[model samples]
Target chain A: EPEVTQTPSHQVTQMGQEVILRCVPISNHLYFYWYRQILGQKVEFLVSFYNNEISEKSEIFDDQFSVERPDGSNFTLKIRSTKLEDSAMYFCASSSILAGVGEQYFGPGTRLTVT
Target chain B: GESVGLHLPTLSVQEGDNSIINCAYSNSASDYFIWYKQESGKGPQFIIDIRSNMDKRQGQRVTVLLNKTVKHLSLQIAATQPGDSAVYFCAENDNQGGKLIFGQGTELSVKP
Candidate 1:
């Protein structure tokens, strides 16, 4: 089965540095999303991208965060400046409108560690 | 405050036994619900989902029950095996941009 895949399974960066987390969503999906989970907390929605624009975002998705679909298959999340609290597992997910929005397929996730 | 939460933090069961995981949602407007399984170091894998219009839905060896009146959902696994051990999370679809509001996960440990 086709699945969502992410690059740089683990990322380590300085607090003030910028970092980009990349994801290649399932081949034919139209909608993409990003979510994060603190070490012991529930996964929280960050942002959703469709048609090259942000469709919806959470309060947690503040000024520091941006998402891009630079190419047909590559969707990325960039943090302008990392904070210690930003360290968490970031996940990329994709879904087809035909499959119902609730049926999202998730990638393994990229573990971001900022020091 | 819209949130989905689990009843228990951890559950241990013997092999060949049945396991039922429960979830509670505070959002009455949430119409779609999904259950996901996450093994160690992996992402949440979609298991099954149900719509509020229906009371029950079933997949192979797995069944999901939704009670919109009580604002509750449950996932039942029959004849659980070692592979069934994982953290399970219940999510409610926000109906916009396909955003899912997830619940705190319940850890299932199958003792073989």
Candidate 2:
């Protein structure tokens, strides 16, 4: 199975610092997404990327958050100014165009700890 | 400490027993649903999915049942094993670019 992969399994950054989380989605996937899970909470959608543009985003994805597909294989989420509340497990997911059925392959996730 | 999967609804079952987890979704427009399993520190792994037109879908030892009328979804694990211990989440898709909305997960503890 070709699974999504993420770098820096764990990230620790000071408050107000910039942090970028990287993901390499399945090679053939066209749609990408970002989500976060606060400790002991349900997963929340952050943003979705397709064709090098943001397709959809949640309120949680505010001005501080941005996503970019700098190259063919790498997708990244950058938080301009991290806050304590930004500390959570950030997950990147991808799916094929037949995504009408909504089966997304998720990476192991990057644990972001903002202190 | 607030660990992942720690505050989720939990079900304890003996080895070889069958486990059924239920979920209630709020969206009537959702046309797709998926079941995912998450280990303590990992991301959600896709297990099985069902389209709105289908009432039941099966995969390996798992089965997903969907009821569009009541907006309910259920995952059935047959002859559960120790490795099946994890948090299971049911997610609904709004049919818009495959964005999934997850429900509060249920923790399954298969006692061996």
User: Top lDDT: which candidate number?
Assistant: 1
Candidate 2: the clashing residue pairs are none
For candidate 1, write residues B1-112 as lDDT tens digits.
Answer: 9999999999999999999999999998888899999998889999999988899999999999999889999999999999999999999985644889999999999999
Stretches of candidate 2 off by over 4 Å are B1-8
DockQ for all models: 0.66, 0.64
Candidate 1 Cα errors over 4 Å, as ranges: A98-102
Q: Where does model 1 sit among the CAPRI classes?
A: medium
Task: For candidate 1, write residues A40-86 as lDDT tens digits.
Answer: 88889999888899988999999999999999999999999999999
- The digit string of per-residue lDDT tens for model 2 on B1-112 reads 1111223399999999999998888778778888899999899998999999999999999999988887788999999999999999888777766678888899999999
Q: Give the CA lDDT, 0 to 100, for residue A71 in model 2.
A: 92
Query: Which candidate has the highest TM-score of all?
Result: 1
